[model samples]
Target: MEQILANGVYLGSQYAMIALGLTLIFALMNVLNFAHGQMYVIGGFVTYTFYGQWGVPFVLALFMSCVTLAILGALIERFLFAPVIKGSSREESTMLLAAGIAFFLDAVILLVFGEKQRGVPKIVDGVFNYDFRLIMPYDRILICVLAILSIVAFIGLMQYTKTGRALRALAQDRTAAQLMGVNVDRYSMIGFALGAMLAGLVGGLLVTITGVNLGMGGPTSIKAFMMVMIGGAGVISGAIWGGIILGFMEAIGLALLYQYGDITYLLIFVSLMIFLAIRPQGLMGKPWG
Candidate 1:
């Protein structure tokens, strides 16, 4: 049970990292970015190429991958989201464009990578032995620590930094924020860049935990969307809570179903449906007026 709990927390941290990025983008943009999972996968591939193939240090590879994706995200925001936002049909256009971009990227990846599952070398080897016979991987512990730090840093930025304040202002009301001298376009680009960087970081860590392949992004994206919906669309705290809840639920659900010889995917779908039905706005979501 102790080991199970430890594993759950570790997995929860990973899920939190991915879900936080989704939450941030959705909170400010009010659009679900279907391309996020692809970004995550691309980050892992970038890390693998830089670190594994080019022999760069793991930390440096992670940094470079994030930076590269951040730039890509800025470009995407400028070219793809900008026109959609300015057009007459805002929501529909934005959704369709993002989804199309996601599909196109996925196809490109499939052609390039050829559906091979590949894992990155662990950042840290060996396990930490806890008192009472509990053993946990040092890398997983690092993930949990990083997760906490990332959340703290993000919160601190939002609460204390000028740019963060501008982001919050834009999130609350774009027109009002623009009138108040916030550069809406620049801020939106920055927010999207940060979101992409977070996805990249999580992707690098994910490669250490599980092998990556072209097809993995789709399921992960579905799970992330479910988590964002369950947590609330526009609330950071909601994302955090929803991520942890879903992570533990998934872990426990899989364990139980394994004992009963039931299908894991079915359980996941059923739980998602139940959550959607019970709280359409999600647990921490404010009702849309």
Candidate 2:
């Protein structure tokens, strides 16, 4: 039971990382960012290419991957999303553009990396035996610690910084923010870059835990979307809570379902669907102050 809880927390953190990024972009740009999964895989591959292949330090490699993706994300926004975000239409345009971007990135990475699985060398090797039934891995522990720290830092940024204030204002109301001289364009860029950086960071974290493959982006995107929808469509806090719910549900389902672990998502999604039908506003979506 303890091990399952631990796994839930670890997996939940990962889901939060992805869902957080997704929520940021959606809040500011009204775009779902289907390309995020590609960014995630790219982050892992970038870290691997540097640390696993080029002899760079693990920490440096992670930083490099994040920097690389951050730049990529910014450039993408500058070129593609900027127009759509400020234009008359939204839903279809953003989805089409983002999907195209996703496909392009996926193809490029597939051509470069081929069909191979790459793993990050265990930076912190070994396990803790909390007795026979409750052993835990250092990597998993590190992931949880890093996740908590990241969440705290993110909250601090949102709560205590000028930029954070601007972001919050925009998230609350873009037109009002623009009226208040909030430099919506600049903050938009900042939000996208931050979201992409988080995506990249989680990618590297995934590599550290279980390696990465070429075809991870699609499912990753789905998981992020699920978290966001379940928690609340546009609420930042909802993403975290949604991720925890999904992670815990997934863990519990896997434990109980055993060999039929794949059924976990089906069951959870059904439950979420029923819940959402009753409360379309999501857990933290509506009634915002």
Clashing pairs in 1: none
lDDT of 2 by residue, 107-215 (tens): 9999987779998788889998788667778988998888878877887898899998999899989999999999988999988998898899889877988788988
- My TM-score estimates for the predictions, one after another, are 0.93, 0.96
Candidate 1 C-alpha lDDT tens digits along 40-103: 9988888887887788998898898789789988999988898788774568788888789889
What residue runs in model 2 are displaced by over 4 Å at the alpha carbon? 259-261, 287-289
Total backbone collisions for each predicted model:
0, 0
After superposition on all C-alphas, the RMSD of every candidate to the true structure, in Å, is 1.9, 1.7
Whole-model lDDT per candidate:
0.82, 0.88
Model 1 ranges with Cα > 4 A deviation: 129-133, 263-265
